[model samples]
Target: MSEEPSARGEVLIVTGMSGAGRTTAANALEDHGWYVVDNLPPQMLRPLLELAGRVGSELPRVAAVVDVRGGDLLAELPATAQQLRDANNLRILFLDASDDALVRRFEQVRRPHPLQSAGTILDGIREERRQLQSIREGSDIVVDTTGLNIHQLASRTAELFEEEGAPRHRTTILSFGFKYGLPADADLVADMRFLPNPFWRDDLRALTGESEAVSNYVLAQEGATEFLDAYVQAVTPIIEGYQRENKSHSTIAIGCTGGKHRSVAMSLALAALLERIPGLRVRVRHRDLGRE
Candidate 1:
């Protein structure tokens, strides 16, 4: 049986750092009924879209996996994608990760980095970053896979692109530890260090923000609600502009000394407030919660 087409045919160009979970994302999209094409060359995008056009609804949501594996030909992707934009509903999704995370993943897989021909894995990664910098900046959605496992990445991908015509805007509220470094994909970042640290409380030290004790402690601090209120008001207009421009995904990072307390509590609270916005989808993730 053929799948029904969406209101308009959609094209998602999935590209990212070599070890940043593109395969996982692709699998998730496929599971959600996207017609996913893997390792497609930049020059082939037009012909692929043309084929989709001829077939109509059979391929309503098409996801093309394009990356640096195309080598120098990758230089042609931005221009090609720009040319096709006027004729199609196109969006680019970029997956990214910290250099440390990418290195760890490469080690775990026991394989050489695709771009790491002679020098160290780090060298290859830096080279790929340089080559992909322009496209990554232009991507409509950027997902950072640094702290996410394959399953989590898959779930995130589904959240961003699943059916029901997709949300007008999907926002991920990510909590992290400043010590673990910033989330590479954050579009907006807010620090919770200004608030009192729940970690300093002996009773709450062992509990995570998900625990009532820790959550209450963090939320009860002065300035907590005020920050959440103002931050929500501040981002509302920016998010609306994103919807106007057809951008569909955004990540707002909340950071504290550690991800286990203040940041986590604030993130959950922020999500609750942001949910009040019309046509917005909110998801909360504690990126560095368990690392400590």
Candidate 2:
């Protein structure tokens, strides 16, 4: 470890296992107003920072996406780490998924892992994990995307890196279905199954939670408003403390038997409540809305 960088722009060193949603993360960072260099070699790391320093406020935050594709050049990261430590300005967001997930992704894309020679995909994944172990251990944040959808992974990326004038922390109020399994990254979960299902009603059956009828029906349940009030009261202080602790990303999974009606309504209602809290950003996603 070294002394933190003083008053310099921040740099995000993004790396990890192959097919672990690095592309999604990089894209999200770019969308978050970061100057992103995709697949940049580690040897250029210092030059990039120097360039950013020269540019000053023009580019206050930069994210470099480094991967196995850099081969020998990737070895320069440890040296770069030493230089960045003092500024306390470097953050490595290590994106990783399970071996099974990586294999599936590689197969789906009809591409072989960069480390794979003549061996199986699993062999390449194993080698990549070994090669990345040291850097991963030293990373500032580790995001496991094994069970997250592309949208969810993108949401995580946004949560991790906040733009200037944006909220310091983000809360993703995700609505999911029990049938599709839980969101692997949700920090907290709420079940809405106790409420009456809109799927059973003829008129609401064809409508989503965003529809006024469905929203009204879902909110009219005996304990619906009470739940939102109670949950907001409970989670508000937790997020305040989270921001105080420098934790940036949080997922609150709200679920029902099916994702379309009750959970979606409740997620919207919850988000409505959370939005009133200062400095806390919220995004609502219906994970299984159309799957039904």
Candidate 3:
């Protein structure tokens, strides 16, 4: 909802169809530092969450996998999820794949469908899809695993949870070059070589973009002003998209011929622009600034 960090335990309840990669998602969350419980009954959802919350100091991240195997208790999931949320901060991540994909996967693995007693595997899949529509809609994040490999899924999940360790709650990595100036890896990268060359400024020639005088001089340019405006417009959507996709870290690289003049100036500008995005962790790096 708010995407704000919660003091209560962060619980990821992973659910979906039988062949929809729920187990893979659960395992990936576990690898990403979540304490995971697989195939727990819906009846145990409340108690397990309570236990996790009490012991969460030792395990702040928790994930649980629930599926149709829970039989009648499976129907209670919506209520259980609401109760858990009322007690703590709970997030549902529904993992799903296309029915064709699921059928192919089950065939490849040679696993019988749990609901096969009623009809064909396709019928079971249709039934499962119908049953899971509500949960799917309620999920905080819906990952379509139709074409994703296990490694890609794990990497994506790690990115989503990367904010857990940040002090500012936002993590930004901005890369700059010394030639064209700094590229705002956040809002925009502005080229600053059009301004008076700080490298040729005699007294300021040896200073880097991080230097206060170079920073001040670069900011006092007409191109820099226009660049900031254009850059903000260009970079805002990328940042928003990354956040929506649950990216934990991002690197914005701005390059100049030597990473000393323009690149450096632009990097500083980008850092300042990114400060407007609340709770973002920001850092700047000059890639070739020190290279001889």
TM-score of every candidate:
0.55, 0.56, 0.54
User: Can you tell me which runs of candidate 3 are displaced by over 4 Å?
Assistant: 1-7, 166-292
Predicted structure with the largest TM-score when compared to the true one: 2
Q: Write the per-residue lDDT of candidate 1 for residues 2-56, one digit (tens) a residue.
A: 4322225889999999999999899878866799999999989887887788788
Q: Which has the greatest lDDT?
A: 1
Model 1 misplaced regions, further than 4 Å: 1-8, 165-292
Residue by residue across 111-198, what tens digits does model 2's lDDT show? 9888989999999999988888888988989999999877778777877787657875789999999999999999999999999999
User: Positional deviation of 64 in candidate 3, in angstroms?
Assistant: 0.7
- On the 0 to 100 scale, the lDDT of residue 154 in model 1 is 76
Q: How much lDDT does each candidate structure score?
A: 0.88, 0.87, 0.71
Per-residue lDDT of candidate 3, residues 2-82 (tens digit): 232334577778898787777767765664567899888877766776676567578787888989888777778888787
Candidates ranked, most accurate by TM-score first: 2, 1, 3
The CA lDDT at 226 in model 2 is 92
- Between prediction 2 and prediction 3, the one with superior lDDT is 2
Error of 1 at 284 (Å): 34
